[model samples]
Target chain A: MTAVQWILENLPQILELTVDHLLLTVPAVLAAFLLALPLGRLAVRLPRLREPLVGGIGLLYAIPSLPLFIVLPLILGTSIREPLNAVAALTLFGLALMVRSAADAFGSVEEDVRLAAVAVGHSAAGRFLTVELPLAGPALLAGLRVVSVSTISLVSVSAVLGITSLGSLFTDGFERGIVASIVAGIVMTAVLALVLDLLLVALGRVLMPWRRPAPRRAGSREPAQVGERGAA
Target chain B: MTSLLEALDWVLTADSWTGPGGLGVRAGEHLLYSLLAVGLSALVALPAGLFIGHTGRGRGIAVVSTGVTRALPTLGVITLVALAAGIGLTAPMVAFIVLAVPSILAGAYSGVEAVDPQIVDAARAQGMSPRQVLLGVEVPLGLRLILGGVRLATLQVVATATLAAYVGAGGLGRPLFLGLRNHDYAMMLGASIVVILLAVVLDALFALGQRLLARRPGTA
Candidate 1:
């Protein structure tokens, strides 16, 4: 049968696979974001710990996913299911990216701004919440966007461990000689990535309303050049 | 020897070619696949990226295309291609090429765009044709950024080429994947070490090359 005919026949299964794919990515990102923020804050305050923590995270990121998955079962016990293992593996990877960005975002908050908050008799906690986080909001959001999309992609690797996600479509399709399954998986992955990226861009705009939206272009146009200068 | 010890002996044996382990054959195949994929992708992406980047009309499309390509999971792309093309080194090669292109293109396009407009105008005023100005001034000036992209693409491809073993395209990943299949912890660890070492070594080499190229007279 033609590719179109095949897609038409398996529309329901394809949709289900797409949903499975989303499930694999979304949860891991949420988990990573929760863990990374505080860890990032701790790393910044300690300063000396930052190097070791960043280095350790980078080392973990360098490790291949497949072997990591194989090894995890030994440490965590064999009873751990595929989805949890996949989530754990992706969480480690995503944390590496998120932690550094989070730290950098927080670090970039102007000292003068923090001093101003302190002059107003704000407590330490109050200053962080009102001054630092607000100023660092855009960068932290950018980092989250990157982490979200990266998590979506990494989840596809989880399929190798027999986790049922959209990646399974590729595995099943390849084994069964079903062309539609492969196409369906690709189209779904691409669409999901696009939608998530747009959502992140919109979120950036909403949170940083004072800052104008830069032209969505291929090369990095400096924020200053895009006429959004000094807003940060 | 115990089964575990025997596997260790096989991996550590210096002469992997005639030894029970498939290490030499796997490493050779892995390198070949990586080089071919990166080379082909660079060839395709450099020109295409330059065109799209220079045209200035399709910046949105170009940006989105690169982001989507980079964001797609490497394993998913490989599995999908392998499904359509059938399994082998070719499948992974095709996948890496797709993966490599967007980064290279982004690099090239951005490098070209980053070239100072004043330089291009100066060249044009000196009676240089548009093509001549692009070839003579823009490309040379943009070399560093374009090369930066190539370095990143090469590193990504080399690291990811380890996945080729999933489809029976032997590489260091062969032991890694097979060890997972058979629950052979030693083999997996051995393979993992080799893969990580190779990635780091290759990354260092590319970084060194970038430094040398950037420092070369008339290039910086």
Candidate 2:
């Protein structure tokens, strides 16, 4: 059968797996974000802690996914088939990526802004929330965009262990010799990643409206620079 | 602790080092797949990326391609390709080559792009041809970043090559997937430890080379 026909028949199953994939991916991305915020900030705050923390996380990324999925059950005392194992591993992967971005994001914040916030009597917490975090917002979002895409993709590997996700399509399709199912899986996974990324971009726009670029004026370079910075 | 011990025991056994499906064979297979994939991908991606970086053209394509490839699930790609191509090295090799291209491409182009334009201009003003400028100036200066790309691609390819076992292709993943099927946690852990060590050693070696290159006078 053609790919479209196969997708039409398996729509419900595909949707269910999509939900499962999202359930695994969304939380991992958010948790990594929350965890990395402190860790990234710490790395930025203490120059001495930067190397070890970032380096350790980089090493964590080097661990192959399948083994991590298999061995996590042992580390966490979870059952072999536990979805938590997958979630935890994905979280580690996401954090490995996000922490570096987080550090860079926080580092990208200008010192003068921090001083300005302090001179206006803002406390450390206030200054960070109001000044630094907002300034770092775009870069952090860019990093999150990457983390989200990768986590979504990585979630599929957990299917080999019988965890349901779009990746199950690949395994089942391969075993059954149904190319359509595999095609469906690839398309759906890519769609999900792109959609989530667009959502993030929208979220950034809504939250950081001032970041919107000014309309182009012929022969003017300043607005173009602002646009480039915003895009970055 | 017992499981960890069992894994270590499995790894340390002389029998695990010899014969078919042994660590030696599996690791050799794994490295072979990784090497072929990365080498082939670099051959394709390096020249293209370097051209793009030198001319500052086709960046949109590079950006979109890298983004799309980064989002591809390697497991899905390998399994799908394997099924389509029938059981053999071809499937995993194709998947791995596809998986590896973006990183090396990004590395080559970005490395070249990161070179100061002023330096390129100076080289040009000395009456050097664009070809000469690219070969001598851009390639040397960008060598570290270009290697960084290859390093990342190698690590990624090596990791993903483990999936070749799913398609009946031989690699370190044989022990991994086989252990999973048979409830052999020790074998699983042992194979994982090996894979992790392989990645680490390669990453460190790449990092050292990058450092040494960066330290060279005028490169930085």
After superposition, candidate 2 runs with Cα above 4 Å error: A220-232
Which candidate achieves the best TM-score against the true structure?
A: 2
RMSD to truth, every model: 5.4, 3.2
TM-score of 2: 0.95
TM-score of chain A of 1: 0.86
Worst 10 residues of 1 chain B by lDDT: B1-10
How does model 1 score on DockQ? 0.31
| DockQ score of each predicted structure, in the order shown | 0.31, 0.55
After superposing candidate 1 on the true structure, give the runs of residues whose Cα lies further than 4 Å from its correct spot: A1-20, A38-62, A71-81, A195-232, B1-10, B15-21, B51-58, B119-141, B217-220
The alpha-carbon lDDT assigned to residue B192 of candidate 2 equals 88
What digit string (tens of lDDT, one per residue) describes model 1 on residues B108-217? 88987887766666777799876676677778788888887887777678778878988768778887777768876677766765666676687678768878888876
lDDT of 2 at A175: 89
